[model samples]
Target chain A: MRRLGDRVGMAWAWGSSLCLLLGLGTLLVVLVTRGAPAVGPGLLFGDTAPGDAVLGRAPVFDGIWPALMGTLALVALACLVAVPIGVASGIYLAEIAPRRRRALLDIGVDMLAGVPSVVMGLFGFGLILLMRRTLAPSATTGLWLSALCIALLVLPYLIRTTQTALDALPESLRLVGPGLGFTRWQNLRHVLLPAAGRGILGGVMLAVGRAAEDTAVIMLTGAVWNAGLPAGLGEKFEALSFRIYVLAAEYRDDMQLAQGFACAFALLLLTCGLLASAHLLQRSLERRWKA
Target chain B: MSPTSGRTRGERTAELLLAGAAAVSAAAVLGILVFLAILAAPAWQGAAHVFTWDWRPFHGHYGILPMVVGSLLLALTALLLALPVAIGIAAFAHGLGPRRLARIVLAAVHAMTGIPTIVYAFVSAMLLVPFVREVFVHGSGYSLLSAALVLSVLILPTIVLVVHAHWHSMGKELERTCAALGIPRGRAVLRVLLPLSRRGLLTAAVLGFARALGDTMIALLLSGNAAQVPGSALDGFRTLTAHIALVVATDTQDAAYASIFAAGLILLLVAAAASLTARRLGAGNGRTEAARAAPR
Candidate 1:
């Protein structure tokens, strides 16, 4: 009976694991099968022009150039806001924070990470409404508000990852730096950060991936639908994710809807590529550092 | 000595600046909570009408009871459906499989964590909605049941991974002692392993529940956009996250629009509480491990 039970349990475990893998694998297969046929230079470089009838047949002459540009703009802006603050806070918590405060701060950061994206959108919408009424009602201010909200959304993740990376470093590095007559700042800048830099970049890349896929926040503030291209930071520009949502949900034309799927596939490919490269880069760097 | 003193002064300044930045980041989180509270103040104070069952923002009714009901029900349903499957998988991975097979299984579970939530949402919208609509009940494709099922898939990775980690971390001595007493492997696992890992299991459940609750896109796309308390799993509903997305995304200017902020405040509070609990549980587990590791 004991032998039988062990056999049963093992079978169950393997079955469950395979189920999970299959489910996710099936999703990827479906996405690729449907999206791959539409991938071409025309799809990449063309604009969705009117008069196209069938799905994937429309004169979407321009690929996702504008949406890609907007995504880049949003991600760059978000990183600028989130990274320095997140890295600095991480440094403080790991290196210098008082014990009691560290616990409180850690809890706060965790909570921040767990806040739902829609709530962030709510916060962004509310903040923008206030800003529009009191400050500037222009699109630039809207972009700033949206960027700030996304930064807040990604900040906790960056801080947590950086802190973990910093914590994983050998204590001897700190000792050696200070013993060599280096100041704490010099020790951190020259020794600790460089050692943990790959991990930090990994975290940043993950955060950027997250920021790129965010639809709820951008939908509320940055969605411009057919507003063409953004004129400036204040102009309401649509992101690929938001555009995918809008196209899938609202578009009456099937070709446009297919174009939406193409956009989603493109976004997914972009993010996966970026993340894969970052992971590879980090691994190579770590290997070099070790050697 | 003078050089060391000068270096110390510079270090102190940098530390102060870093500390200040950390403080500001912490404050930014608090500021979001405060801002939500302030924005939702009118609704909470009953100065604004948020109890109406009607969801016509154009007509000035801002009752969010339906959205709240939909969100909670969908999350609960998802939890109920996913818990059994996730635990079953976790148990299998932890105790049932061959060592080589288990490693492969574990890797698959880890990979699931990296898949984006939107991808899951999109797949469900395209695949599950139509299937549910066709096979289960006619004209009922986008019901709460579909949303729950999709959400279950989305959070399955988190649940399975957490429980697996907890199970793997258990001391081998306990198992050996049980085996020496002629206890069957199944009984030993049921009686010893499950009980020891109860806290971790509960934490996993709570986290999964929170993830399901917090999910927006799946519910937005598949929950049929109906602002009603779902009478059955097959009935359509509008979740809080979905409603917030819809209201904010569509509403131009209205006091009724502030109700989205009210809903957000509720979600924030719930998420914060769950996060704090999970963290404490994790810290407690770490301490327990350390205590056990000490020469006992």
Candidate 2:
């Protein structure tokens, strides 16, 4: 009886993970079944256009090409702004900054990272509205505001990972660089950077995943429900997650619902791919740095 | 060389550039605070309409207390339900399972963290809603319960990963000692591992609570958008994040626009508190917290 009870208890321990597996498994199965019908040639190939008003849109269903492009643009713009700052801040925190000042700055970064996505959107709205009211009276929601918000969002993660990567290096490497007659700048550029490249790249990839799929920030910034591809700096744009959201909430009919699912699948696929690569690189960073 | 002694011009310039970039992050946070305060100034000074709980269509009582209470209730429900499951998974994956199985479970939790929040919202909107509606026999499945259910799942992966890491790092020695003394692994785990990592458990729960609190889409899609005082799990209720997301888009006028910022300020306070707690907990302990705090 005692042995049996112990066995049951051990089984219960493992069973804990079963609850999580089941919940996620159910979500995956439901989405696949519901969304699978919506995936086809036009879903990936064609551009998304407005329906109902035209009584006809496109023969190939005019998939989310525009939203896909918009998502790419959002991530690209965010990375372009944040990458340099993030990488630089990472090195500063890891190698150079004063300890007391770094602690205060770290708290600020953590707070920034913790701000909810919608609040970030609110900030972006205020930014554009402020510009509209004062500087550019005709200014509209645009790419720069969303990029800035997302860049802020992604900055903390990048900085953290890069710092971790740099701090993980052996003191011997730092000493060796100096002993070999390289200056501080040269040492960082040559030996230290090459060693930390995988980790920094992993962090960058994770930030890309974050900026690409962020809905709330982009929703209130530049993203539109169904607009033509964004043309200029201040022009409104469409995004995959936002498109899914508006469609899901409004819920016109079954066809629209199907389109929402397809967009979701595409969004999920993109983020998942990016995250998977980041995960592999994170593993490599851990393995290589330790070895 | 020390900072003041042998610093060359090239080194000084490079260091200054790096430090300037770091300053940009700090400035962004301060800028957000100042901007939010400026935008929210009108609401603080405005008419009392924005403070009422009876929200009506197009324009209604803008009182934010109901949404605040609703958000609190939803987060409480999710935390209460998720804590045990997360603890169980973490403990099991760290101790009870074989090495390969442990690796797989941890990987699964990590992958789940990366799933976009909108995908979860979509699933809940489609599947959880009607099921909840049928079970409760109330408003469509868009209820506090549904919101709680999805948010619980959303934060579970984070909590489990955090708690599991804590348990493995801090509790494993005790487990090994108990096993060598002829104790059952389960008893040892319950008695030794669980108690030893109380701080981690608390942090895990706190991080999970914050994530659930800030989540907008699950509540927005599943929680019936009913901006009123919540009655029960079956009743639909609005959350602060959801309310902001819903109203901020359309409320471009005077007090109403400022009211959204006021709502944002409340969220910022809560988020700031969470950040302080995370900072105290040390940087390396809560990887999932950062992941959960960001969008999706």
Candidate 3:
């Protein structure tokens, strides 16, 4: 009877694993089939200029250049903001923070990470957007506000990753730094960070992927739909993810929807590439450390 | 330790600056709370619309009970559907699968976690919606059921990864004892491992539930945007995330905008409570490695 129960449980486990594979397979196939046809040079580099709207005929083509640029710019700025802070906080937690402070920081990061994207958007609109408009109406372009929100969105993840990376270092290295008569901060900077550079890079990659894919926060922060490139930091921008939302929600035509799919494919490719590299880097670093 | 020593001074500055940067995380939480509190103040004054269930923003009646219920229905249903399957995957990877297969499965799950929410949105709206409509002639494809399915898929990777971490941290004592007793590995997993990691399972469920509830893309694109309480899984509904995303964009500087902030406040409260409860449960679980991985 025990053997029979084990057999059934084993079967159930295998069945469920199959289900997992199937779910992933289905998503890939669906995305590929629908999104592949829309990929072309026109969709890649073509401007968002509605040719027909400008020339008094139906628009000939719509491209993802402006949206793609918006996403890349947001990712770049968010990485610039989040990577440093996240690494610092992670180092503090890993090395300098007292135990009680560590727990406090952990809970704070967790809560911030858990806050929904839309809620972050609301926070952005109410606090940054409103404050900017009130303080200096010229700063109400929404670019900086959205970038800051995306930074917040990815900050917790980077911090956690950094913490794990720093913690994974051999304990002997901790003493090695201090043995050289280095202060706590110098010890970390010269010894710890260099040792954890690959790990930190992985974390930055994840943050980049995360910031690029966020739509709700961008939507509230004046990410224009099908607009030209943002002229300045204080100007409105567009993003690939918001374009997906706009095309899906508003445009029912096959052409417009196909454009959305192309954008999805692009976003998916970029996210997958970054995330895969992070995974590879983590694995390679782990193997090297073990060796 | 000399005041004029450049190295010492630089080190001290670095520590102080990083500590200040670390403080930004806590400050962010406080900022969200304070600003949301200030914005949601108007809805607290016993507005007549606050007590109702309908949401006719044009006429300015904004009772968000429907959105509240819609969001709950989607999240809870997704949790219910995903929990069993995700736990099963975790068990397979840690308990039953061969080493090579487990590695592959783990890699796939890691990749899945990184997939953007919007990709899930696009896939579900394009494929799952049509499939559901064709399979069930009685209802539209963009119903609560479709939303739940897509969200379950999106969040399953979170559960599996968390549970896998927990399972790995459980150590080899159980398997060794099974070898001594003549019990099979499968039975030990079903009876021993499953019973042991109950708290981790609960954490996984809460985390995944919060994720589903907070998602805007799926709710916006696949849930049909119907701002009413769904009568059944086959019916359509609008979630608070979707409501805030749509309403906040168009309804600026009005009571409706304030009401949407009120909805965001509620969402913030739910997500905070969920994550807090999971953290509390993780503390009780006594596995720090698993707890760290459980936050997604």
Among these predictions, the greatest lDDT belongs to 3
Ranking by lDDT: 3, 2, 1
**Candidate number that wins on TM-score, 2 or 3:** 3
| Per-model i-RMS | 6.5, 2.1, 2.4
Model 2 lDDT tens row, B1-296: 56555578777889999999988986777788888998888666646366667666456456787888988899889999888878777767766677677777777788887888898898778777888778778677788888898888888886787787676666457777898998776667666777777778877777778788878888888888787877777888899888888776665455567667888888887877876785577355655334433423
Per residue, candidate 1 scores C-alpha lDDT tens digits across B1-296 of 26736566667778888898788777776888999988888887775688667777777778899998888898888888888778767776665555676667766665555555666677677778889988986566889878888888878867777676676567678778888999766566655787788788887777778888888888999999988888888888899999888876665566866688889988888887876777677553432111111100
Worst 10 residues of 1 chain A by lDDT: A53-62
TM for every model, in the order presented, reads 0.88, 0.92, 0.93
Worst 10 residues of 3 chain B by lDDT: B287-296
Model 1 Cα shift for residue A73 (angstroms): 1.4
Rate residue A259 of model 2 by lDDT.
78
Residue A75 lDDT in candidate 2? 87
- Model 1: DockQ against the native? 0.38
DockQ for every model, please. 0.38, 0.57, 0.59
TM-score of 1: 0.88
